[model samples]
Target: MKIAFVINQTHKEKAGFTTTLLAYSALQRGHSVYYIGLADFVYLDHDKIAAHARIIRQIGNIADTQQLIDALKSTSKERVFMDDFDVLWLRFDPVLDMINRPWAAAMGLQFAQLAQKLGVRVLNDPRALVDAENKLYLENFPEEIRPRTIVTRSYDDVKQFFEEQHHEIILKPLKGSGGKNVFLVNKQESKNLKQIVEVICRDGYLIAQEYLPKAQYGDIRFFLLNGKPLIRNGKYASVHRVQSTGEIRSNIHQGAKAQKAVISPEMLQMVEKVAEKLIQDGMYFVGLDIIDDKIMEINVFSPGALLQASELNGEDYAAAIIEDLEKSNGKNKTE
Candidate 1:
């Protein structure tokens, strides 16, 4: 199978990232893998979409993901046509480049959308991704499964929402990931509410959500592939992230520990509620941040921690994803 991962930058990826694991798994399976940076795309005169991709052909046994990362970094890039690949995985985070290279992610998605139109399968459907670019995407799901929230750049709106939620609310950048700029503001911190809103809104809009008391215990990072739980050997590919003491954000990169997730019937029910829409939207791979019954976020763009989940569950979740991709490619070929 020919698969190209569109990432923020080839040099910026880490061995621990889910993208690296998936790429390594594909290489281990003897498939062609390429890494395309967000700024590497080109549009030729004949409507051809190409990229100066970092190619990592399947070679001798790759010992680990670190080795793959080493090879990817050392290897020189070559122009590759996007349509020739079976899958063009959009794995770049928009917020990462929102400041300096604000045009990078948008241009990458535009190319991905064009590639999809030109018959190359694009994951997470770029058309839907345009709308799902921020926290507002969660509002598209059933209201019962989401926290009471308001998105605004107005300090008055945030202040009003905080007061409505009993002076307790979660403030975050509407388009951010990895818990950057996430804050748990309570009554005691009400004095700084305006400043917090101003900081978060500088990037774009800010999402002020009713603070879930259960968030004190952290949240679950649930993985879903093709709108269903990714499972292997009777274990689901999910992780329970426990934040450090006094911390409110449960993102793994934010001093949170990844433990084996305890999936409940209620969690599965929540999955069912959002499954149809996700499948319809072509969000082939997804991560949901759940706290109790309400989903704090839906991660469709570059969700991390699959490696941690696999390590905690003692399963090869990356292999499962690659195998699924192979099957999907085969099915598409037959169709």
Candidate 2:
């Protein structure tokens, strides 16, 4: 099958990371692995999509990992119709980019939607990504599993939320990802409350949630593909991200270290309950931020943790992910 990976620059990604391994595994399986980034696509007014893709030339004999990497690196990219590919993997990590062009992020989804329309399977459907962009998207989970939450920018509303929740609050930017500027506030720090709320609220809405104190230990991340738990043997594809000393946020970007996690029944239940809806929403894959027994975040757009999970479980998740994509494409089954 002709598979195209929409990703960040090659060589820059850490070796053994899931994205790299997936592409490597795909190439090893003799699938035509085309690596395209955000800069590669060409969306047209004719309701058609195209991309100048880095289509890999198959190597006759096997060599080393570097040889395989160099082989795909040597592609002479040319414009091609999106309809030509059997799969268009939207693998770019939009949230981590340095965007001079904000429209580029939105455009990737636009093109992915078009690719799906053209009969190419686009992972983690474009529409779900748009909704997931909002931090309030976490509210879509079962209310019992969530803390007292309010999505509002109004200062009065936030203040009232603080009062209602007894200032047991965690504040965050609704538009932000990877735990940047997520503040855990108590009534004693009321001095900084207004300023923090104002700054985050300026972006869009503020996610004023009752702080889940269980977060002090760490957070667990569960990777789900095609709305099912992506497990290997008996171990699950998951990690317990213990935050580096003094850090409140356990995001890998925020210096969290990945350790093995036992996926508890509660965690599985949460993922199961949310899976069908996520799959229905074009959410081909996602990582759930399990803080305590509750989900703090649903990372749909370019969810990480596969590499961490791989390390923790000593299994090849990147290969598993690529294999799943292959199966999804091969079977062409419906939800």
Candidate 3:
């Protein structure tokens, strides 16, 4: 299988990232793997989609993800046609480029959509990704699993939601990740409410959600593939991230510690609630952030933590994902 991973940038990727693991796993399986940055794509005349991709060469000699990262950085990018790839995996964080290269993520998606139309499999369906680009996408799911939330660029709207939620609310960029600019506000600390809203809205809109008290204990980062729990050897691919002292964000990169997740019946039920829509949207891979009984976020674009989940659960989730893709593509060919 020839798979191309579209990421924010090759230089910005780390060895511990889920994208690295997937690419390394594909290489270990003797499949061709390529890394494409958001700005790497080129559109030729006659509707051909191509990219100057960093091809992971000599996969046999590369030992692990660090080596893969090194190769990706050291190797010069070579032009490759997108249609030649068996899978064009959109693994980039849209918010990463939203500031400096506002056009990068959208252009990447546009190229992915073109690639999909040309019969190349694109994961997480580009069309769906367009609408799912921001936190508002969570509204598309059943309200039962989501927290009381409001999206606005107005400080007054945020203030209203804060008052409605009894002066406790979580505010963050409507389109963001990695816990950047996330703020937890309460009645006693409402002094900075207006300022926070102003800062967050500078980029775009801000999401104000009823603060779940359970968030003090951190949240679960659960992995789902094809809208189902990614399980291996009776263990689900998930990690319970414990936030640092006095911190509200449980993002792994935001000083959160990863531990084995204790999957509950209620969590599985929540999965069932969102699974159908995810499958229908062609979100082949996703990550859900759960606090208590409500889902705080649905990460369709580059839902990470698979590596940490694998380490904690003693599972090979990357291999499982690659194997599933291989089988699915094989079945498609046979059909």
Instruction: Sort the candidates on lDDT, descending order.
Output: 3, 1, 2
Per-residue lDDT tens digits of candidate 2, residues 1-335? Answer: 77787876654555445566666667666776777777788877555689988776453563544665666566578888898888787776665553355666777887888888888877767777777666677788778666678888888888888888877788997777778778888877877988998888665677888888888989998888888998888888898999988778898868999999977787788778888778788787788888887887787776777877887799988777777876867733221
Model 1 lDDT tens row, 1-335: 88899999988999999999999888878888899999899999456889999987774656998888998999999999888888899999999899999999889889998898789999879999999998899999999999999988999888888888998999999889878999989989989988888888788888889999999998998999999999999898999999999889888888998888899998999889999999999999999999999998999998889999999989999999998998877833111
lDDT of 2: 0.76
Cα lDDT tens digits, model 3, 5-45, are: 99999889999999999989888877878999998999895
Where is model 1 more than 4 Å wrong at Cα? 331-335
Q: What does the lDDT read for residue 45 in candidate 2?
A: 57
- What's the number of clashes in each of the models? 0, 2, 0
How high is each candidate's TM-score?
0.97, 0.88, 0.97
Model 2 / residue 240 / CA error / Å = 0.1
| Highest-lDDT candidate | 3
Error of 1 at 95 (Å): 0.7
Reference-based lDDT, residue 205, model 2? 77
